[model samples]
Target: MVDYKLELIILPVSDVAAAKAFYDKLDWRLDVDIQGEGGFRAVHYTPTGSHASIIISNGLTDAAPGSTRGTYLVVDDIEVARADIASRGIEITEVFHEAQGGIPSVNKEGRTPGLAPERASYFSFAIFSDPEGNEFILQEITTRLPGRV
Candidate 1:
């Protein structure tokens, strides 16, 4: 069997500089920034403790800016992560757990207030978005499901 790994994700942004600034504020590691001929430019950033990195560039895809959503970043502690991000001046949604149905709803309506009562991994989450409206969810996951690792 072939091994597959997710290394990069391309994010569309209306302004490259603005996006760069936003990610910088989040304290993500700036991996590279390259400019090429014909108005080409690429910027790569990796969040702290994340193996996968995100690429922001021009002339790479036709996707509209801010159209990307639901990207997730897993953490061991949702409250600490949320507070850290919020301390950086980023606005974050309140922490929420999955509703009684065992699946997160499509929007805020499906979320119940506060953390998961059982402290279940992958059950708690908080949401935030970049300046371009690219949404990201921070999920608390202290353990992985069987074979996930």
Candidate 2:
């Protein structure tokens, strides 16, 4: 065994302070705050009762601001999540579907399930970019039609 359950996810940001503020508005609690290395410090925070955590670190290399990657969040209520996030003064982009063809089934090669596209359905979601230009998506799986997986 690896002897480890999940650890942490570190994201590089141009401005640690601004990144911290953005996450703060999301109601995330800070776990670690270390800025003693002449602004080379990093901040750690976690979403309650989750094994995953986000760590915003000062650029240790050539990485620049808004260089972070995308993150997807599956929420119970997309609208509520959008409203709450927007109310925090965070900029939210438009919400739409990615045009998934349909739910995935057995793979062609039987190796793995590569892509399972989502089509039009009762529920909807949206996508938005963080201050650092990191794309994030909010999705809601509301209803499961009969005989549809």
Candidate 3:
């Protein structure tokens, strides 16, 4: 078994500058910005509380465009959060129910579907892909224990 805390998601891009601009527009804060070191350039960003880190890099040994790499950002309110993100021009991915305890559950198509709903866990989430086509998700958990579905 492996104990994991912090995570790093490295995304390769053809144009690092363009990728940085797109993420910036989303109001995603940028971390250390290093350009031109040993033929590698990188820019890092992490959501609040250091849930996960996204690294935009160039001149990497591995990784290609449209490579799927992402994380889940938990949210409190899925509808409100999805609306806010939609206003920002990001699209949600899927809304489905995970069965537990012989009960059926539902969540918004993108940012609201609570993962493992039967567990009564809060995990309202939304999925979005970067400009380079790498997909990631934001999740928010509100309540614990099953609610009236």
Candidate 4:
């Protein structure tokens, strides 16, 4: 069987330079920035240790600016990751877990302050947003369950 690996995500941005500055502040590695003819531009960045990367570009997609939501980043330590991200001049939400052990919903109704009871893996979370309001969730998972990689 051929293996299909997820590689890059394209994010639509009204201003490429502003998006570049925002990701730069997070210290994500800057992979490339290109400006082509007819004002087309693309900037790529990858989070440290992540195989997948993202592109914030002009003339790449027709999606609205900041339309994406609920993108998640897995972490082994929620507090440490959240703290480090917050210390980088990012405004992040307090740590929260799904209520009654439910999955995190699109809205804020299911969230409860602080980590999950017993600090269970995959239950604790924190949230942050990019300059254009793209939401990202940092989920704490000390151990993976079953076949998750």
Count clashes in each candidate, considering only residues at least 3 apart in sequence or on different chains. Answer: 0, 3, 11, 0
Tens digits of per-residue lDDT, candidate 3, 105-143, equal 234322234444643444334577778787766555566
Residue 36 alpha-carbon offset, candidate 2, angstroms: 3.1
Error of 1 at 43 (Å): 0.9
Tens digits of lDDT, candidate 4, 73-141: 889899999999999999999999989785678778888999999999999999898888778889999
Per-residue lDDT over 1-149 for candidate 1, one digit per residue giving the tens place of the 0 to 100 score: 99898898888887888888889999899999988898777899998998999988775789998777888999999999999999999999899987873545576777988898888888898899989888898999899999987
- Computed on alpha carbons, the lDDT of every model, listed in order, comes to 0.87, 0.63, 0.63, 0.88
Question: TM-score for all predictions?
Answer: 0.93, 0.68, 0.67, 0.94
Clashing residue pairs, candidate 2?
66-132, 100-117, 100-118
Which parts of model 3 are misplaced by more than 4 Å? 1-3, 37-39, 94-125, 143-149
| TM-score-sorted candidate list, best first | 4, 1, 2, 3
Identify the superior model by lDDT, candidate 1 or candidate 2: 1
- The digit string of per-residue lDDT tens for model 2 on 1-61 reads 5656657766778788888888888887789988765668788988644567878887454
Model 1 CA lDDT for position 105: 58
After aligning candidate 1 to the native by TM-score, how far in Å is the CA of 20 from where it should be?
0.6
Off by over 4 Å in 2: 1-6, 60-62, 102-123, 142-149
Tell me the spans in candidate 4 whose CA falls farther than 4 Å from its real position.
none
